[model samples]
Target: MAEINMRQAISDALWEEMERDEKVFIMGEEVGVWGGTYAVTKGFYDHFGAKRVKDTPIAEAAIVGAGIGAALVGLRPVAELMTINFAFVAMDHIVNEAPKLHTMFGGQMKVPLVIRTAGGGGRQLGATHSQTPDAIFAHFPGLKVVSPGTPADAKGLLKAAIRDDDPVLYIEHAAMYQVKGEVPTGDFTVPIGVSKVQREGSDVTIVSYCRGLQLSMLAAEQLAVEGISAEVVDLRSLRPLDMGPVIESFKKTNRAVVVEEGWPSYGVGAEVSTRLYEEAFDYADAPIKRVGQKEVPLPYNRELEQSALPQVADVIAAVKEVL
Candidate 1:
C-alpha cells in the first residue's frame, strides 16, 4: 500500500495504463504542453511524447468527437474536457453518440473511450463553472458514470474505465485533488457499478460519493464522539449503480442520510433515497434524509460558495434527523 494524494493516484493510473498499453493516449486542451490544467498529467508529455500526448483546441466537441473516432478505430482515448461545465458543448457526442455506438452498430463496434472531467463548487469558480450535473450524464443509457472519493478508488476505477469496452464518464472533484489516502501498489482495478462500505457503524447509514464521501467520513468521526454510530457508504459508480452495499447498510441501520455536492432535486441524493425506499421500505425506521447543495447558482464569493455547498455540519444534521 502507498499513501498518496488524488492527483498522484490519478496520474499514476494514467501513466501506468499508457505504459502498459500502446493504444492508450490522452487528448485535451493544455493536456500535453500544459501538463493538464490540474497537473494530473504533469510529466506525461515528456514521457509519452507528442504523438501519444495530444493537445487539441479549446473545442469540447472536437475533443470528444475525435475521441469517439479514435475509439472506433481500435484506440483507447482518454478525452479530457477542462471542466464538466464544458461538457454541454459536447453533449451530443457524449450522451447521444459515443454511448450508443456499440448498440447502434449492432454490436459490431465498440466505443472504448473515457471522458475525463471535473465538477464541484469551492475555490470561487462561480455558478457557471461549478455545477455538478453528474446525474444528467448518468441518466443516459449505455454510458458508464463513475466518481471516486478516495485515492485508491480513483486510481483503480480510472484504470478500469480506460480499459472498458463501453463509453465512460469519469467524474472527478476539482476540490479533492489534494486529498490523500491509502492506495494499493500497481495493477489492480475496482469493478465499475460497485459500492463500498467505507466505514461500518450500527446506528445510521451515511451514503455519498466523490467529495461528499470525504465530508461524510469527517461527519462520522464527529458523530462517534456523540455516541452516534454512522456507517459510510461510497457510491463509487453512479450509472450502473450497485445498491448492494447501501441496501445492506440501511438494513442494518434502518436509517439513512444521503449526501452529495450536487443539488437534491432529481440529483444523486434523490435517486438514492428513492431506491432505498422502494427496495428497503420495510426496513426503514425513518424517512431517508438527504444532504445536498442549496438549490441556487454557486456564488463566486468564498463565504457564499461554501454556504451553498453541503458541509460536514449539514451531513451530521441530516444523520441526526434520520435517526
Candidate 2:
C-alpha cells in the first residue's frame, strides 16, 4: 500500500487507464497545456502528448457533446468540465443527450464517456462556483454516478468509470484534493453501485459520500468517547446505488442519519432515507434523520459558511437526537 492524496490518486488512475487502453484519451479546457485547472493532470500534457491530451475551447456543452459523439464511435473519452458548476451550461447535452444515447438507440450504441468534475464548498468559491449538483444528474436513469470519499476509492472507482460502457459522472470534492489515504501499489478498481461501511458500530448508521462521508467518520470517532457507537456507511456510488450494505447496517444499528454537503431536500440524503424506508423500515427503531447544508445559497462569510454546512457537531447532535 502507498499513501497518496486524492489529486495524486486521480492522476494515477487517469494515467494508468490511458496507458492500458489505446482508446482512452482526456479532453477539457486547460487540460493539456495548463495541466488542468486543479493540476490533477499536471504532467499529462508532456507524457500523453497533444493528440491524446487535448485542450479544447471554453465551451462545456461542446466538450460533453463531442465526448458523447466520440464514445458512440468506440473511443473512451474523459471530459473534464473544470468545476461542476460549469456543467450547468452543458446540462442539455449531459442530462438530455449523452445519458440517453445507449437506451434511445436500442442498445445499438453506448456512451462510454467519463465526465470528471469537481464540486463542494469550502474554497470560498461562493454560491455560483461552489455548488453540489450531484443529485441532479443521479436522477437521470441512463447515467452512473460515483463520488469516492478516499484516495483508494477515488483511484479505483475512477479506473472503473473510465472503463465502464455507460456514461459516468465522477464528482470530486475540491476540498478533498489534498486529503490522503492508503492506495494499493498494484492495479485495483472499486466496483460501482457498492457502498462500504467505514466503521462498525451498533448504535446508529450514518450514510454519506464525498466530503460528507469524511465528516461522518470523524464524528463517529469522537462519538466513541461518549459511548455512542455510530456506524459510518460510505455511499461511494449514487445512481447505481448499492443499498444492500446500508440496509444491512440499518438493520444492525436500528437507527440512521443521512449526511450530505448538498441541500437536504430531494438530495442524496433524501434518496437514501427513502430507500431505507422502503427496504428496511421495519428494522429501524427510530425516525431516520438527515444532515446537510442549509436550504439557501452557500454564503461567502467564513463563519456563516461553516455554520450553514453540516459539521461533526451536527452529526453528533443528530445522533443524540435520535437516541
Candidate 3:
C-alpha cells in the first residue's frame, strides 16, 4: 500500500473510473484545463480529453441540471461544485429532479449522478465559502450523502458513488485534502451507509464524520492519556445512516458524545442524538452529549471561526461530562 493525500486519492478514483466505464464523465467549473479548484482533477483533461473532462460556466444549477439529464439518459456524470456553498444554487435540481426522477416515475428512470464539492472552514474562506451544508441534502429522502474523512475512504466512497444507480452527494472537507493515509493499490469500494469504528474502546463512544472524525480521533488520543478509553465511530454516510454500530458501541461503552461541525439546531449531531435516544436509551449510563458548532452564523474573523467550531478541548470536555 502507498500513502497519499485525499486529493490524490480522489483523482485516482476518477481516473480509474473513467478508464473502467465509458459512460462516466466529469464536468464542472475549472475541472478541465484548470484541473479543478483544489487540484483534485489535475491532468484529467489530458488523459480523458476535453469532451469527457469539461469545464463549465460558473452556473451550479446548470451544471447539476445537465448532470441529471445525462444520468437519466444512461450516462454517469460527476458534477463538481467548486465549493459546497455554491451548491445552494443547484438544490432545486438535486432535491427535486436528481433524487426523485427514478422513484417518482415508478422506476422508469435512473439518475446515477455523483455531485462532488468541497466543504468546511479552516482556510479563512469567509462565511460564504465555508458552510457545511450536507445536512440539507441528508434531509431529503431519495439522495445518498457521503462525507469521507481519510484518503482511502475518499477514494473508496467516490468509486462506490460512481457505480451506484442513485444520486450521491460526495462531500470532501477542504482541510482534509492534504492529509495523508495509506491507500491500497487495487480497486476497492466501501459500502455506503456503513459506520466505521476508527478506535475501539470501552468507556465512552465519540460519533462523527468527515473532518470531525479527525478531531474526535485526536480527542480520543488525548483522553487515552487520562485513562479514558473512548470509541470513535465515523458515520461515513449521513443519509441511510448506519446506526447499528453506534447502538452497539453505546451498549458497550454506556456513554456517548457526538461531534459535528455544523450548527447544533437540527443538525446531523441532533439527529444522531435523537437516534441514540430512540434505540439505545436504556444502554446509556449517562445522557448523550453533542458537541457542534455554535448556533450562530460563522464569522469571517479567523479567531471567531475557530471558536464557533468544535475543537479537541471541547470534545474532551464533552466526553468528561458524558462520563
Candidate 4:
C-alpha cells in the first residue's frame, strides 16, 4: 500500500506507463520545462528527457492535432491541455479528428490517445479559466471521459486511459490534486466505465464524481449524525458511466441526490436523474434532487466563487429533502 496525493499518483502513472511502453510519450505546452501547469509532471523532464517529454508551443489545437497524428502512427501520446477550460480551443482536433480516426478509416487505424486536463471553480480562476464542462466532452460519441475522485482512482483510471485503444478525455479536479489517499503500489488498474460505492447507506443515495464526491462524502458524515444515512456512489468514469451501481444504490436507498460541479441543466446529474427515472422509477420514493454550480460565469472573488459551487450544506439539505 502507498499513501499519496492525486498529483503524485498521476505522476506515478505517467512514469510507470512510459517505462512500460516506449510508445507512450507526453507532449504539451510547458510540459517538459515547466513540469506541467500544476506540477503534475514535476520531475518528468529530467527522468524522461526532452524526447519522451516533448514540450510544444502554446497552441492547444497543435498539441491535440500532433497527439492524434502520433496516435495514428502507433504512438501512445498523453497530451496535456493545461486546463480543460482551454479544450474549446482544441475541440476541432478532439471532437473531429481523434474520435473519428478509428471508424473514419474503417477500423484500419487506432487512435490510442489520452488528453489530460484539470477543471473545477474553487480556485477563483475566473470565468475564462475556471470551468467544469465535463458533460460537454462526454456528450460526444466515441470518446471515453474519466473524472476520478481519489488517489486510487486517479492512478488506476489514468493507467487505463493510456492503455485504451481509443481517445480519452481525462478531467481532473484542481482542488483534488493535493488530497491524499491510500493507493496500491503494485500492478493495479481500475477499469474504465465503472462506479465505486464509497459509503453504504439506506436513506438517500448521493451520486457524484471528482470533487463533488468529496463534498458528498462530507455531507454523508453530517447526515449520519442526524440519523439520515446517505450512501455515496462515486461515478469514476463519466462517459462510459457505470449506471448499474447507481441504480442499485437508488433501489436500496429509495431516494437520490445527484451532485456535480458542472451546470445543472444538461449535466451529468440530469442524465443520471433521467436514467434513474427510466430504470428505477418505481424504486424511488421521492423525486430526485440535484445540486450543481450556480450556472453563472465563475466569479473571481473568493467568497462569490465559494458561494457559486455546490457545498456540503447544499448536499445535506438536498439529501434531507429527498429522504
Candidate 5:
C-alpha cells in the first residue's frame, strides 16, 4: 500500500493505464503542455510525448467529439474538460451523441471514452464555474457518472472507467485533490456503480458521495463524540447507482441523512431520500433529512461560498434531526 493524495492517485492511475494500454491516450486543453489544469497530469506531457498526451484547442465540443471519434475507431481516449462548467458547452455531444452512439449503431461501435472534470464550490470560482450538476448527467440513461471521495477510489475508479466500453463522466471535487489516503499497489480497479459503506455505525445512516462524502465522514467523527453512531455510505457511482448498500444500511439504522454539495431540490440528496422511502418505507424511524448547499448562485466571496456549501455541521445536524 502507498499513501498518496487524490492528485497523485489520479496521476498514477492515468500514467499506469497509458503505460499498460497502447490505445489509451489523453486529450484536453493544456493537458500536454500545462500538465492538466489540476496538475494531475503534470509530468505526463514529457513522459508520454505529444502523440499520447495531446493538447487540444479550448473547444470542449471538439475535445469530446474527437474523443468519441477516437473511441469509435478502437482507441481509449481520456478527455478532460478543465471544469465541469465547461462540460455544458459540450452538452449535446456528451448527452446526445457520445451516449447514443452504441445503442444507435446497434452495438456495432463502442465508446470507451472517459470524460474527466472537477466540480463543487470551494475555490471561489463563482456561480457559473462552481455548480455541482452531477445529477443532471446521471439522469440520462446511457452515460455512467462517478465521483470518488478517497484517493483509493479515485485511482481505482478512473482505471475502471478507462477500461469500460461505455462513456463515463468521472467527476473530481476541485477542493479534494490534496486530501490524502492509502491506495493499493499494482493493477487493480474498483467496479463502478457500487456504493461502499465508508463508516459503519448503528444509530443513523449518512448517505453521500464526492465532496459530500468527506463532509459526512467528518460529521460522523463529531457525532461519535456525542455518543451518536452514524453510518456513512458513499455512492461512488451515480448513474449505474448501486443502491444496495444504501438500502441495507438504511434498513439497519432506520434513519438516514442524505448530504450533497448541490441544491437539495432535484439533487443527489433528493434522489437518495426518495429511494429510501420507496424501498425501505417500513424501516423508517423518522423522515429522512437532506443537507445540501443553500439554493443560490455560489458567491465569489470565500466566506459566502463556504457558508452556502454544505458543511460538516449541517450533516451532523441533519443526522440528529433524522434520529
Candidate 6:
C-alpha cells in the first residue's frame, strides 16, 4: 500500500488507463502543459505525448462537444472542466448529446466519455466556483455520477468511469484534492452505484459523500467521546445510488442524518432523506435528519463562506438531534 494524495491517485488512474487502452485520451484546458488546474495531470503531456494529452481552448462547450464527437467515433475521451461551475456552459452537450446519444440513436452509438471537474467550496473560491452541481447530473436519466471521498476511491472509481460504456460525471471536491490516504499499487476499481461504510456504529447512521463524507467521519469521531456511535455511509455514486447499505445501517442504528454541501433545496441530502422515508420509515426510531448548506449564495468573504457551507460541528449537531 502507498499513501498518496487524492489528486495524485486520480492522475495515476488516468495515466494507467491511457496506457491500457489506445482509445483513451485526455483533452481539456490547461491539461497538456499546465498539468490541470490542480496538477492532477502533471507530467501527463510529456509521458503520453501531445496527441494523447491535448490542450484545448478556453471554451467549455467546445471541449465537451469535441469529447462527445470523439466518443461517438469509438474513442474514450476524458474531458476536464476547470471547475464544475463551468459545466453550465456545456450542459447541452452533456445532457443532450453525451448522455442521450446512445438512447436517442436506439443503442446504435455509445458515448464512453468521462467528464472530470472540481466542485464544492472551502478555500474561499466564491460563489461562481463553489457550486456543487452533482445533483443536477444525477437527475439525468442516462448519465452516471461519481464523487469519491478518499484517495483509494478516487483512483478506483476513476478507472471504472473511464472503462464504462456510457457517459460518467466524475466530480472531485476541491477541498479533498490534498487529502492523503492509502492506495493500493496494482490496478483495481470500485464498482459504480455502491455505498461504502467508512465507519461502523450502532447508534446513528450518517450518510454523505465527497468532502461531506470526511466531515461526517470527523463528527462521528467526536460523537464517540459522548457514547454516541455514528455509522457513516459514503454514497460514492450519486446517480445509481446504492441505498441498501444505508438502509441496513439504519436498521442497526435506527437513526440517520444525511449531509451534503449543496443547498437544501433540491440537494442530494433531500433525495437521500426521501429514499430513507420510503424504504425504512417503519424501521427508523427517529426522523431522518438532513444537514446541508444554507439556502443562499456562497459569499466571497471567508466568514460568510464558512457560514454558507456545512461543517463538522453542524453534522455533529444533526446527529445529536437525531439521537
TM-score against native, each model: 0.99, 0.99, 0.99, 0.98, 0.99, 0.98
TM-score of 4: 0.98
lDDT measured at residue 136 in model 2 versus the true structure, 0 to 100: 93
Worst 10 residues of 5 by lDDT: 314-323
Scored by lDDT, the top model is 1
lDDT by residue (85-158, candidate 6, tens digit) is 99999999888789888988899999999999999987887778898878988999899999999999999999
Pairing residues by index, what is the TM-score of model 6? 0.98
In the predicted model 2, the residue pairs found to clash are none
- TM accuracy, model 2: 0.99
What tens digits encode model 2's per-residue C-alpha lDDT throughout 138-251?
A: 999988999999999999999999989999999999999999999999899999899999889999999999999999999999999989999999999998999999999999
Off by over 4 Å in 3: none
Q: What does candidate 4's lDDT look like per residue over 1-323, in tens digits?
A: 88999999999999999999999999998899899888988889999899999999889999999999999898999999989988999998998888888888799989999999999888978898889999998887888999999999999999999999999999999888899999998867989999989999988899999989999999999989988888899999988888999999998989999999999999999999999999988998999999999989999999999999899999998888887
The total of clashing pairs for model 4 equals 0
* Per-structure clash totals for the candidates: 0, 0, 0, 0, 0, 0
* Per-residue C-alpha lDDT of model 3 across residues 1-323, encoded as one tens digit per residue: 89999989999999999999999999999999998889998999998999999999999999999999999888999999999999988889988888899899899999999999989987777778878877888999899999999888999999999999999999999888889999999999989999999899999999999988999999999999999999999999998899999989999998999998887778888899899999878887888888988877788899998988889999999999998
Which residue pairs clash within candidate 1? none
Clashing residue pairs found in predicted model 4: none
RMSD of 2: 0.8
Sliding window of 10 residues with minimal summed lDDT for model 2? 121-130
Per-residue C-alpha lDDT of model 5 across residues 1-323, encoded as one tens digit per residue? 99999999999999999999999999999998888888999999999899999999999999999999999999999999999999999999889988899999898889999999999898988989999999999989889999999999999999999999999999999989999999999989999999999999999999999999999999999999999999999999998989999999999999999989988889888899999899999999999999999989999999999999999988988887887
Candidate 6 regions exceeding 4 Å error are none
- What's the lDDT of the predicted structure labeled candidate 6? 0.92
What local distance difference test score does each model get?
Answer: 0.96, 0.93, 0.92, 0.92, 0.94, 0.92
